[model samples]
Target: MANAERRYSKDHEWVRVEGNEAYIGITEFAQDQLGDIVYVELPEVSSSVEKDEVVCAVESVKTAADIISPVSGTVIAINEELADQPEMINEDPYSAWIMQIELSDPTELGELMNAAEYATYCENEE
Candidate 1:
C-alpha cells in the first residue's frame, strides 16, 4: 500500500512534498520486487533534473533500477546513508527517502497518483 500523504509515479517512485521541496524514494513494492538492495546512486546536490528524468539508480541482488523524478527541480539533498546502507530501503522505503528536490513548478504534483489510485495501479500491474 502507498502512504496516503505521498504521491506515486507509474514507475513506482514516491514523492512526499513539503512546501517547495519534495522527498523522493522508491515504494515498498519496488524494493520488494528488486530483492535485497546493495547500492544506491543518487544525484548530487544543486543538480537540476526534469520531471520523469532518471535521477537515481538502485541496485539489488536481483537487478538494478532507475528512480525517476516525479517533478522538475534542483536536487537539494541526498540520503548519503544509502551509500553504505542501501538495505535501509527494504526496511522502510518511505522513511528512507533517497533525495530532496526543490520543485521548479509545484503544480507538477497534480499529475501524479494519490494513494488510492496508486494502490489500484499496483494491483493492475501485478
Candidate 2:
C-alpha cells in the first residue's frame, strides 16, 4: 500500500511534504520491480531541479532507473546513508528517502496523485 501522507508520480516516485521541504524516493512498487538495489547515485545538495527532471539514479541487480523529481525545488539534503547501504531502499522504500528539496512552488504538489489514485495507476501499469 502507498503511504497516505505522500503523493506519487506516474514515473514511480513518491514525495512527502513537511513544512516547505519535500522528501523524495522511489515507490515500493518501483523497487519491487527493479529487483535488488545495488547502488544509488544521489543529486548533490543545493542543486536546483525542475518538476519531472531526472534527479538521481538507482541501479538494481536487474536494471537501472532514473528517479524523477516530482516538483520544482532546490535540493536541501540527500540521504548520505544510501552510499553505504543502498539495499536499505529495498528494505523500506518509504523510509529510505533519496533526497529532500525546499519547494520552489508548493502549488505544483496539486498535480501529484494521492495514495489511492497512485495505487490504481500502478494497477493499470501492471
Candidate 3:
C-alpha cells in the first residue's frame, strides 16, 4: 500500500509527487488486466514529454500499452532493472516504476484522485 493514499489517473496510472519529480506507474488493476509483463520500453533520461503523451511502452501476455504521462515534463530517470526482469511489475506494480519526470505543471496533481478516491473509482469502473 505504498500509494494507498496517492493520486491516480482515469487511465489507471498513478502519480506520487515527491519534490519536483513525480513517480509514474500503472495501477494494480491495469497490471491485472495486462497479465504477466514481458517487456518494458522506457523513455530516455533527459527526454521531454507532454501531458497525456506516451512516455514509454510495456508488453504483457495479453497486450501492450503506452505508458502515458500524467503531467508534462522532462524524464530524469528510468528503471533499468525492468530490462532483466520485467515481471517485477506483476510482482509489485507500485514499486516497479517505469519512469520519473521533473513536472512542468504542479497543478496537474490537484486534478487527480487520492488512493481512497481511486479505489472507489476503480470499484465503480467494474
| Residue 87 local lDDT, model 1 | 95
Candidate 2 per-residue lDDT over residues 11-120, each given as its tens digit? 99999999999999999999999989999999999999999899889999878899989999899999999999999999999999999999999999999999999999
Local distance difference test, candidate 1: 0.92
Query: What pairs collide in candidate 1?
Result: none
| Candidate 1 C-alpha lDDT tens digits along 29-101 | 8998999999999899999999978877999987889988889999999999999999999999999999999
Q: List clash counts for every candidate, in order.
A: 0, 0, 0
Query: Rank by TM-score, descending?
Result: 2, 1, 3
Give candidate 1 misplaced runs (Cα > 4 Å): none
* Estimated TM-score for each candidate: 0.97, 0.98, 0.93
Better of 2 and 3 by TM-score: 2
**Model 3, range 26-105, lDDT digits (tens) per residue?**
98998888898999988899999998887788999778998888889999999999999999989999888888999988
Higher-scoring candidate on lDDT, 1 or 3: 1
Query: How much is the lDDT of residue 90 in candidate 2?
Result: 95
